[model samples]
Target: MDFFRIDLSFWLQLQFSARVALRLPAAPRSLRERTFLVPNPILGVFLHWLGGLASGSFYVPYRRVKHWAWETYWLVGGFFSWIIAPWLLALLLTRDLFAVLRE
Candidate 1:
C-alpha cells in the first residue's frame, strides 16, 4: 500500500542518513573545544532533518516521471538511494566496507 511504501522510504532514508553521519570525520579540534553547538553534531542533525524531508517527498518527484510505471520509478530510485549510493560511499569512507559483513 501507499502508506507502507512511504514508511519504508522514510526508514530507509533514516538508515542511510545515520550511516552517512557516522562516517563523517570528527569536528575540528578548535570547534570541538567549544562547550555548545558542536559543529559535526549540529551538521548531523541538520542532515537528518533534510533527509527526512526529502524522504517524505520522494514520491512527489517520482509521480512526475513520465513513461515509467510507479513501481518502476520507485524501484529504480530506491536501488540508487538504498544500495548503490551507500555502497559507493561506504567504500570511500571505510577502509574495508565488507569488513563489517564478515561477522
Candidate 2:
C-alpha cells in the first residue's frame, strides 16, 4: 500500500511537470502580442485553461508524500518546478536567455 501510494505520487508529479512544460511555450512576452502567435483565440483560451488546471492540481501530488517534513519536500519540488525547469525552458525557447534575464 505504501509503495503504491509513493508510485502514484511520482506519477502525478510527472503528469504535473509535463503539463507545466506544455504551458511554457504559451507564455506571452507582451500584452500586444498575447493572442497573435497562437493560431486561434480558442486555442489560446484552451491553453490558458489547461495551465490553470495544472496549477490548481499541482499540490495534489505533494499530499501523498510521507515521512518527510513539508519544507523538505516542498523545497525539492520547488527546485525543479520554479528554478531548474524555468531556466532550462527559457534557455531552450529564447535566443539570448541571459540577456533577457538581465533585463
Candidate 3:
C-alpha cells in the first residue's frame, strides 16, 4: 500500500540519518569529545551476541509447537516480543512508569 511504503521510506531515511550522525567526524584535533552516551564496545559485542542468539533461535521453538498455523505463531510471537516485553520491563525497572509514559 502507498501508506506502508511511505512509512517504510520515512523509517529507512531516519535510520540512515542516525547511522550518518553516529559516524565519527573526520577532522578531530579538538580537546573536547562529544558523546551519545552509548555503552562500551564490549557491551555492544555482548548485545550483538544476545541479539544473534535470539534471532537465530526464533523459528526453532515453533517447530516443536504442534497444531498452530504459521500465521498464528508469528502473530503471537510478534505481539509478545513487540508489545508485552518492553512494557513489562519498563514497569519493573522504572520508578514512575505512568508519569514517563504520559509524557
RMSD to true structure for each model, in Å: 16.9, 19.1, 13.6
TM-scores vs. true structure, each candidate: 0.44, 0.43, 0.58
| lDDT of each residue in 1-103, candidate 1, tens digit only | 2322232211122236446533334556664443432246776899999999988977777656787987898799889889999889989998876887785
Give residue 88's lDDT in candidate 1 (0 to 100): 92
Clashes in candidate 2: how many?
0
Candidate 1's C-alpha runs over 4 A off are 1-41, 56-64
Residues 1-103 of candidate 3: C-alpha lDDT, one tens digit per residue: 2322232211122236447533333434341232224236887899999999999988887887878988999998999899999999999999999999899
Query: For residue 19, what is the lDDT in candidate 1?
Result: 68
What is the descending lDDT order? 3, 1, 2
Candidate No. with top lDDT: 3
TM-score of 1: 0.44
What are the per-residue Cα lDDT tens digits for candidate 2 across 15-60? 3644653222332345323221214688789999999998898777
Off by over 4 Å in 2: 1-40, 56-64, 101-103
lDDT of 3 at 93: 100
Best by TM-score: 3
Candidate 2 — what's its lDDT? 0.65
Q: Which residue pairs clash within candidate 2?
A: none
